[model samples]
Target: MSDDPKQVLRYPQVQAEELADWRFFLMRLHARFRTGSFVRGLELVTRIAEAAEAADHHPDVVLTYPHVDVDLHSHDVQGVTSRDVALARRISEIAAELGVEAAPREVSTLELALDVPDAAEVQPFWRAVLAYEDHGEWPEVTDPGGRNNTLWFQEAPGATGEAQQRFHLDIVVPREVAEERVDAAVAAGGTLVTDEHAPAFWILADAHGNKVCVCTADGREASGE
Candidate 1:
């Protein structure tokens, strides 16, 4: 609610200890424009604004002639959310549309590791499902994006006896795409764990018996509530 547009723009930054939800995004600006011309900066802001509009999410933007800094958060939820990620993707796409090549160093990836009793079985299922590849140990799964950052999965030692996971991923897809993907997952040896009574999300377990959910984007929107 800050009057200054720049102040309203939330650039991706390290989250304070109390603000853990905001840490999911990695923010970056074009280096050449960082101290460059005003007109160019305004152009960047316009492009960023367009992207935000497209995603139905607005980011906090700071403009200084040739340089612009952007921060993305879901104000509706009062924190960073998947809406922020969708907006960030659009922003990066807009930058590319404007002929501004993102510097290699400007990219970042967030790594997440999951503990499963059978790392070997769970890793391959995820790698194939997400189109990720092997990176570290045989049981590890990794997805490398532009920033050389990766989402990793490794075996949790002594985890064979646990019957339930403390955390899991909710794989969201468009409503039309959900059944196909769910069927494919089932064909790949995943089992139906539970049906969400809401019909918006279905929990499925992989071969190793680890659970994940196949959900609709709208369902995710509701769950986040």
Candidate 2:
């Protein structure tokens, strides 16, 4: 755990916890604001983009008429870092200036990640099996109408054997509730694989050896992308 990459701090353990007033959910600093009008939402997006540019950080912005959602995470490190926390505070300030009301509960999204030897070779089978339309670059398939969960394929560690994990679940939850979830899983008899990524993710397994990751914004997604 000590030898692993250094930027994997989870939730309140982050570098700038004091400045980050936004909610941590689904592996990103997520917040939704009621902009009151389509034009207002667009303006808010512009402000956010400018703020992001100044901070040298960017966020995934979902701008719907009268609603704007922003998700911030450090993609390179596959977790939320100090940069995300700082930027989230800036976003909140921008929202306040715009008189936007936060409705973070309204913004939540989940995705499925599958690790395989090669995404290109295995994508077709999963696509056909799930009937999800191919979209974006390699390693992603999505429901056309965005109704069902989106799927992402990742390259597995070479030759994952019986002991290595072949499949796992990444379950995202609000940052504040993360610890409780981990406790429940432990109480239910799951084994903790590692706490090195706590707040980001907790790797655990059931008695039969079926593994699942209770993941959050800081949890590293298995996908390289």
lDDT leader: 2
User: Candidate 2's residue-wise lDDT over 27-121, tens digit each?
Assistant: 56777889889999999999999999998888888888878888788777756777777788889899889888888667678888766566665
For candidate 1, lDDT tens digit of each residue in 100-202?
Answer: 5444344234566676666666665665444456754445554443322344555566665337556677665677877776777777667777776335877
**Global local distance difference test of model 1:** 0.56
**Candidate 1: segments with Cα more than 4 A from true spot:** 1-108, 128-150, 162-164, 196-199, 218-225
Q: Cα lDDT of all candidates, in order? A: 0.56, 0.69
- Tell me the alpha-carbon RMSD of every candidate: 14.5, 16.6
Best by TM-score: 2
Candidate 2, 109: how far from true, in Å? 1.5
- lDDT, residue 67, model 1: 58
C-alpha lDDT (0 to 100) for residue 116 of candidate 2:
54
